[model samples]
Target: MQRTISFADKPTLHGTNVLLRPVQASDVAASLEPDHEADRLTGTHPTPGGLSVEQRQDWYATRADHADRLDLAVIDQATGLYAGEVVLNELDDDNQSCNFRICLFYSRNRNRGLGTEATRLILAHAFETVGLHRVDLEVYEFNPRARRVYEKVGFVYEGTKRQALRWDGEWIDAHVMSILAEEWAVHRGYPEAPAS
Candidate 1:
């Protein structure tokens, strides 16, 4: 029998540096701060403008009602502040797979290992608790730091989508990566292979 996974049980996942919990409307303020560096690093399209307070609040407020996807707020444990977000979306039940994405909204949250811990916590919940068979992601070629983080967590380099993103009139490649449940069973988060 195929194992079914439920994204509805939004659990608060704790790590050494970060805590991943259900998103709240109160998170609107911290999460809405605009950072050009962050937008560039994530290869996000420039929105016409920043979201209004009401729009952000309403967006976060409805996160709990979505059963098909998991959206968690990344909290910096030391300061207990909203650091960013980690999400598992585009769920394919028949394939027991989903897409993973994470971002630290501000410069303060980067380089502190918060994103790494948050990534591990969510992947653990995805494979061990949710019984997912696969999780995948795409990283822009310009962002090797983010790609390295995904590699350290056992996501294997699958392939590259050439010129998948167009930023400021220049095209950029997007590297595809994925991790299987079998791989996760062995590595959990850190892979055992010797670093090249």
Candidate 2:
């Protein structure tokens, strides 16, 4: 049976030159492409599991209707192309916090400041709409690009787990980062970007 979930109807978020909307059936193809390639480059950081296109589709189908997870498709507004994907996963029952992850499928889309803006939108929604106290993430120390983006949005490095992830044939450290609602409030300087 297909599970149904109720989410904020209009999950539209604007970035510097892109927009993030809830992931849909049509996006499965594009979203799967970059994710497959990214696996080879980074080799699954937090979760040591190998990547597969079918696995990604199944994962998306399962959470696509889940209320607790806000999975989004990153779109380049200028060309109307899919840039990547981002999500707020594992929401707590108290509605006080959740974890986030983002992946840009196309390498050309990187270094264009889209990540910072996209992250800002997600962080804004997490604090304002989700009414969460904290938003946290784990980054492989090797993924400095993502770490930089998170830091730009005020996520401080709280700690690190040495050799927490095994990729290829080696183990690597993972950085733990988090940001409080109070800190996010100050960064956006808004009352709250209401939940849709």
Candidate 3:
């Protein structure tokens, strides 16, 4: 039997530092509030007015029903709190590729390796479980830290879309990166590991 990919069935993935599970409504109230620093780092545009709490809750409440994409809440195991989110969207069944993204709502969650572990967990699911051929993402050039995490997970730089984001009267380049199933088989999402 051919193994199939189904985003409809939500899953819980455990990692050393984090857990990836379907987003809960509580996560919206507790960890999904808009943060300017996260938006800037992820190159997301701030809503002109911002979403009402109800709107956000409704969004998270229905994430489990989406069949075409997977949205997982990043839970910090050490603190047992909702630290952030990791999403796999823009699915291309024909090509077996998807776009990847992640964000941590609070600064305390940043630089703690939670994001890296969360990323690896999801990528393993994408390639090992879902059998996707490729997973891609875009990172603003201004955020080298994020790019480094992507690199550590085996995503290779493909190219850059020049000045893809204009923020604060400045142009920011967006770097496109991707990892292939073949690559994942070799690295298992730890491309930076020193060979023993």
Candidate 4:
């Protein structure tokens, strides 16, 4: 069975200091490098359920073909280099909802406002172009930096899944966060309506 989905080309989203564009085939290898390095450094390598580099490439190819997933590469508009990646996944048509995930591949980009800005752009696209009523995400408690960015984007703490993830033989808690369309409108200071 085939799923109906949509993707926007050069869907330029303006961040505080970056621009977000659709992920291209050329970015697969480079994008995966940082993710792998980060995982190794943080001792959070993927489990059996996670995808390998080849698997991720295949997945990206599939996602690129489907409109249901919006995966974008965050670019630093100043230098025009790949800063990170952001994605709105698991799009549910019946509920008009999706979950989001983001990561800044380069360590140099950390602690800057880049992540927050990139997040805002993706959230705006999800709630605006994608016409999603709700957006949600899960973050490990250890990843305080990402959690902070999510909070800044108006994602409220819904609850926690105790010992939800096992990393390096230790259990970690996962924080469930979500934002409603109304909340997004309030954040953007606009009345609820589709973007033109």
In angstroms, give how far residue 10 of model 1 lies from its true place.
0.6
Residue by residue across 39-86, what tens digits does model 4's lDDT show?
Answer: 733446656767777777676566567667788888888788887788
Against the hidden true structure, what lDDT does model 2 obtain? Answer: 0.75
Instruction: Provide the clashing-pair count of each candidate structure.
Output: 0, 0, 0, 2
What's the true lDDT of residue 88 in model 4?
A: 83
Better of 3 and 4 by lDDT: 3
- Give lDDT tens digits, candidate 3, residues 88-196: 9988887889899999887899999998899999999998888899999999988999999999999999999999999999999999999999999999988878999
Q: Model 1, range 100-191, lDDT digits (tens) per residue?
A: 99989877889888888899999999999999999999999999889989998999999999999999899999999999999999878989
Best model number under TM-score:
3
Which rank order by TM-score, best down to worst? 3, 1, 4, 2
State which candidate, 1 or 4, has the greater lDDT: 1
TM-score of each: 0.94, 0.80, 0.95, 0.81
C-alpha lDDT values of all predictions:
0.90, 0.75, 0.89, 0.75
Cα lDDT of model 2 by residue, 35-134, tens digit: 5446643455545565566776677666655777788888988889888888887777564677888888767777888777888888787777767788
Residue runs of model 2 more than 4 Å from their true location after superposition = 1-10, 31-37, 40-42, 45-62, 189-196
